[model samples]
Target: MLLALILALGGTMFLQKAFTPKLGLDLAGGTTVTLSPVTQTGQSPPEEILDRAVNIIRDRVNGTGISDAEVAKSGDNIIISIPGVGQSEAIKLVATTAELRFRQVLAMEATQVPQNLSTEAPTPGASPSAQPSSTAKPSSTARPSGRQSATTPSASPTGKALSSALTAPTPGATPEATQTGTGRDQTGQKQNNKGKNGTPTPAPSTPPTAPPNQDPNAGINTQGIDPAVLQQFQKLDCADPKNRGQGVQDDPNKQYAACESDGSAKYVLDVAKVVGTDIDTASAGVRQGTVEWIVQLDFKSKGAGEWSKLTTTAYNAQEPRNKVAVVLDGVVITAPNIISPIPGGRAEITGGFDQVTSTQLADQLKYGALPLKFQRSSIDTVSSTLGSDQLEGGLIAGIIGLGLVVLYSLLYYRGLGLVAVLSLVVASILTYTAVVVLGHNAGFRLSLPHIIGLVVSIGITADSFIVYFERIRDEMKEGRRTLRAAVEVAWVRARRTILIADAVMFIAAIVLYFLAVGGVAGFAFAMGLTTLIDIVVVFLFTKPFIALLARLKFFAKGHPLSGLDAERMSTEPARTTTPQEA
Candidate 1:
């Protein structure tokens, strides 16, 4: 059963196309990004803040399913090294400020054509309208728009309308309008919006609010906004690259104008009622009995009351006023209408989300907001030539060590050495197959330290065989039992010692793995894994094979070459005939 199970697991490597174990950044080479902190006061960020940022970035990278990523603080910059090439998305995710805020949507305008509206079949033999009809105004009776329910597949008129607008040029948009926008589209497709100098124009900062936080609903009353700010909003085109709002930092105390994440729409949002700090936890999951993905949020105690108040106000408002915009950084990630007041500080944001996107969004919110902003200083691709050379050297050393172990065993144990060699072979096969399978399924990666750990385990495995063999020889030296009887008696004593020793090593490995990070953790993991394999081989193969050999004529009769000759062993003194026995 054990051999068959191992073979079955090995088969999965072919199915997963994971023929080789995943290599770490040191071995495979990868991209490294450096981000310098940007503080409001133009001073260096404190050490504690940088450390916190490193932890958050590390969590975000790991949360995205990338393994063996290295995040560390260097001087005033944060350096992130990810294994493999073309990891642009990971680079972007780790560098994002991820400032999360919840603000009331005062007004909204679609930037792209809605998918449903654009794909509608025109009437046959009917004249096509020159212009698309305007979307109907949302009403109190309307099903909540923008956000999709987790249990349903029904499209949201608001969400579909916004997402559709991103694909093609907006109707009636001029070449000048399109050429002014510079960032990639919501799907990460780069757009051609370079300036006459062939460089991208920086996004302009959001217009400052005239009266910040004075009126809670100031954004809803367009008259209350400064003419210049309102004019900026009116002229802001979501299709324009500079207006997509990628890097703008907006103050939570002020009303701001921004485009949706997908460049589908634009909105004027009121002061933030709740921010990332208010979020106690965030997670992504599917609704019960449903396959649709959703992001759930839990608010802090004070934030719960504020959340309830915000929802109640929106639920009682009209049209776009009833919607709440979830702004990350300066972009509106989503604007969902509140059908009813959501209490208890728990809320769900459901839209067109798959497992991957939902988890990404959840991780961003769960890690909390960074205390300071960061700008990417540079991105460099590391070379693996050094790692390759190191690997070659390490392998050569291991081979030499293994060869010596095998040579010593053969010279000392003679015929029994063959059993030790076969046991080593079996252990190696199990370890290799297990690591490959785990790399495919659990994102395990092999690094230099892991290699060292594996090489060291050879001695650990050989130690087990030596213990059992010596115990058998000790029983033979007593001259009270035959080879067959000694095999069983020796095993009874040897296994107890073997289990205790392995147990101690396994416990140490577990502690080290949890307490350490990066390469140290990898070493501990490799050590623990091989130790377990050693136990399996000793109990299942080594003992059983030796028992079978003990039944053979050459071994049972103690041939001199068999290393079990009676003359080679020192026996107890012969018992003298006692008077009663004689």
Candidate 2:
């Protein structure tokens, strides 16, 4: 089972190219800083307070999944290094003391419509005249005319005849020299009035107002509204579903909104309330009925009071209740006008959310809570050159260390050194496979420390071989009849000792892995992994292989190339008449 597991793990590492360890600062390349207590009135922060703050910052950092992040204390300050991740994101992560707020729009650009006309009013039935969709554009042929009608007695003879005579065109008129002595109509014919001098007199302009069809819905035709107002209208980007693209979301300055919707009613809206900061938590989830996604927020006590008050006012208004918006991290998550005062502190923001969007909101809100209010210390682009140099240096050291191990084993062990060599070969195979597989599965990298662990493990593998071989020699001196029998006896003792040693090594690796910080933890983990593999090769490939060799004449008859020669072994003398055959 053990051998199978080892082989499988190794194979997986080799075959898959998947590994995603949280990278260290050097490899990932990002900024680092120490944040000191911003003392006021020369008072320093208490050590305990600072430590608690660090813990919260650490949680936010680790949630990021970047490996080998260094968060430590230096004197009264905290040092944070963000490698291989965006500094802006990290800064945002820490900086948000989760100061949530809901601010009312006090005043908006004049182009934005007011509280009454958000365009969400249900169009009960379609009217061809109301066909201007929000996406519709103005057309030249659809121009409109404006007129004012009065309830007057044109029925009186003088009034009636005077209007007709003054307004009427002459019967045989070439062009009416019907120049009005007063401000009266050449009303119709004045459009083509005659003049003796023929100075080409222009038609008199009428008082300006919205033309019958030059509607606000045609949107701020410059003649209809101020040009500066038109510019403000264009800058609008309303995220509101009803007037979506009509104007920007609730501007802090928007006390009133004036919207020119496509064929929709022109309305002015008054913001009754501002969104409050202080939501306890925000989560995104599916709403009931249609399974639409929504952001659910639980407000802090004070914020709840503020929201309830706002809702109360909106609910009592003549219009339908529920107009409060829940803004998260700034974006309006959901802004449903209140139909009634929200009884409790819970708010569900239902826009057009999906499962993925809900999950994203939940995640953001989850980590967004922080212990410390962060101030960005510094930011700059990082260079990978230093990391490359370190990697090269680490590799060189590993090669040198491996070379020494090979040299020592070869010179001292002589013929038996081949077993050591073979064990190393197997260990390397196992170790390399594991590292590769771990890289794929867990995103591990081969740092200098990790390489050192592998190289050092070669000695551990060699030790197991020496222990087993020495055991075999001991058994032979004790009258074990054949090399194969002696091999079995040695294994019994060698196996127990190997197991004990491996247990110790594994425990140490785990303890160190958990306690140590930065690259040291990687070292501990790699060491533990290799130590287990070493045991596998010794028992499966090493012992069984030696057993097979003992059956061959070349090795059993003590060939010099065989590490297990008779001369190296202490053979027991014949015990004459020693024991009756049992």
Which candidate has the top score in lDDT?
A: 1
| lDDT to native, each model | 0.70, 0.50
- Give the TM-score comparing model 2 with the true structure, all chains together: 0.50
For candidate 1, write residues 1-582 as lDDT tens digits.
568867787788778777777887888888999999998888889999999998899878764232678899989899998887878878888877778888887766555532332222111211111212244212111111233321221223333211111111111111111223443332324456567887543322232344654753344456444455566677777766577555566889988888865555677788899988898988887643356576778889988889889978876766566677878889876675554566667766654467877877788889866667889999999876458788888778878878888898888888888889999989988988888988777667777888888999999999999999999988877745677878899999999999999999999989998777777877888899999999999999999999998878777777778877766666543222222332
> Candidate 2 lDDT, tens digit per residue, 1-582?
647866677556446644333334665476676665554445667777777767666656554222445578887667787665566656555544442334322122112223343322111121111122233211101000111010010112222111100111001101122224211121111133435765333332222345766753342213323344445444444424355322132434343333322211122233324343355766665433234455566767876676677656644532211123334433333233232344356555433346755655454455554433445565555654347678667667767776776677666555566667777777776676666666544446565567667767767777787788788777766765566677788899999998888888889988888777666887887888888888778877888778776677655555656655555554534121211211
TM-scores for all predictions: 0.68, 0.50
The reply for model 2, stretches above 4 Å from the true place, is: 1-23, 26-29, 33-46, 59-66, 74-77, 85-368, 383-390, 410-416, 439-445, 571-582
Report the lDDT of model 1 for residue 284.
84
**What is the lDDT for 567 in model 1?**
61
